[model samples]
Target: MAVGLWLVGRRAATTNQPQLATWRLTLALPCLALPCLALPCLALPCLALPCLGSWLLALGSWFLMSDLDA
Candidate 1:
């Protein structure tokens, strides 16, 4: 799970005093947010068609959150 990996990685980084790894994670957060930022491209009304991909987003959210509780 991502949280487990993040926790283990954080503990390891703390113990190791890994400055570079900290920077890498910090940099990657913004890049991960880029797609979400661009998602406004889907907001068009007439031709955009919200119904087109609503189900895909639902399935994607479920899959993405599946490992959270574990």
Candidate 2:
């Protein structure tokens, strides 16, 4: 989980286009969702925690970058 979050944070750091990043995250949902439907109990945490954490990290990175630009 830490490794995955670290990768997400690094990606968020390098990503210059916020809109593109938003779109990519949006697009990833269905891809994550379909697998979760197969095994709800096992997949929920697998789908939810990392996804939510990574997204929050992405948003935080975006906000921080915007703050720096201001």
Candidate 3:
């Protein structure tokens, strides 16, 4: 879903639709972040602290990037 949105946004940009591009790209951010937020829960018992930290970092970065878009 994230990849699809990103591609759609790129296509919109090349076609001169700035608003569509921005909206799709903005939507993609959370889609990208969803896996990061989910992975820790799925792998918690096996991966523990390291997995949590990395996913948290990813989630944080996603939030930061999303904020920049706003």
Candidate 4:
């Protein structure tokens, strides 16, 4: 579902320019990837304590990203 959204949004944003979309996606990758990584860390037992760290980092990163856009 996320991949589909990414593809649709990229296609719409770049029209027929695949390379442009790819480059733009590369820049956006970390923002998307970090939360995916953190979510699992936040749900597990072995890394339970680190879960708070992961959640906080994800929240901070998202806040900063949106703040920067404003």
Candidate 5:
């Protein structure tokens, strides 16, 4: 969902539509927070691996791509 919104924002930016890009990027903020909010769920054995793996992946991607907009 965050990726989708980011893509939409990028497309909007490429098309010279700043307003649409801003809105799409703004909406993606909450989606990005999902992994952080779910961190506490890692305490459950059943969710440990999956949750940790996804959280790590999201964190890695965030760090790697964070400079794209700069």
Candidate 6:
């Protein structure tokens, strides 16, 4: 979350162009992909924690990146 926000902040600092907005969205997308990607590793309990944590983190990151009006 912190890093995503930091990246958004950095990008926002430069410009608010549609391209940059697209870039932010692109950067933010990994969060959604993470949970799905984690599924394959869930067969192992030890792998589950990190994947679950990543899923949660990514979900949170998506929210932080997404605008309410959007």
RMSD of each: 15.3, 16.6, 14.5, 14.1, 15.3, 15.7
Tens digit of lDDT per residue, candidate 6, span 1-70? 4475467667776775557656555554444456554344434424554666877899888998796648
Summarize candidate 5's per-residue lDDT along 1-70 as a digit string, tens digits: 5566668888888999989888655544443555564334423424544665777899899988987866
- Tens digits of per-residue lDDT, candidate 2, 1-70, equal 3354346556866876556545445544544554533334234533655565666799899999999999
Candidate 5 contains a number of clashing pairs equal to 0
lDDT of 6: 0.58
Reference-based lDDT, residue 52, model 6: 65
Candidate maximizing lDDT? 3
lDDT of 2: 0.56
User: How well does candidate 4 score on lDDT at residue 5?
Assistant: 43
User: Which stretches of candidate 4 lie above 4 Å from their native place?
Assistant: 1-44
TM-scores for every predicted model: 0.29, 0.36, 0.40, 0.36, 0.39, 0.36
Q: Is candidate 1 or candidate 2 better by TM-score?
A: 2
Worst 10 residues of 5 by lDDT: 37-46
Q: lDDT, candidate 4, residue 3?
A: 81
Judge candidate 5 at residue 30 and give its lDDT: 41
lDDT agreement with native, every candidate: 0.51, 0.56, 0.64, 0.60, 0.63, 0.58
* TM-score of model 5 (CA atoms): 0.39
Q: How many residue pairs clash in each candidate at the backbone level?
A: 0, 0, 0, 0, 0, 0
**Model 3 Cα shift for residue 14 (angstroms):** 1.7
The C-alpha local distance difference test score for the whole of candidate 3 amounts to: 0.64
lDDT of 4 by residue, 6-27 (tens): 8856785778777766655554
Error of 2 at 16 (Å): 53
- The 10 consecutive residues of candidate 1 with the worst lDDT sum are 40-49
The TM-score of candidate 6 is 0.36
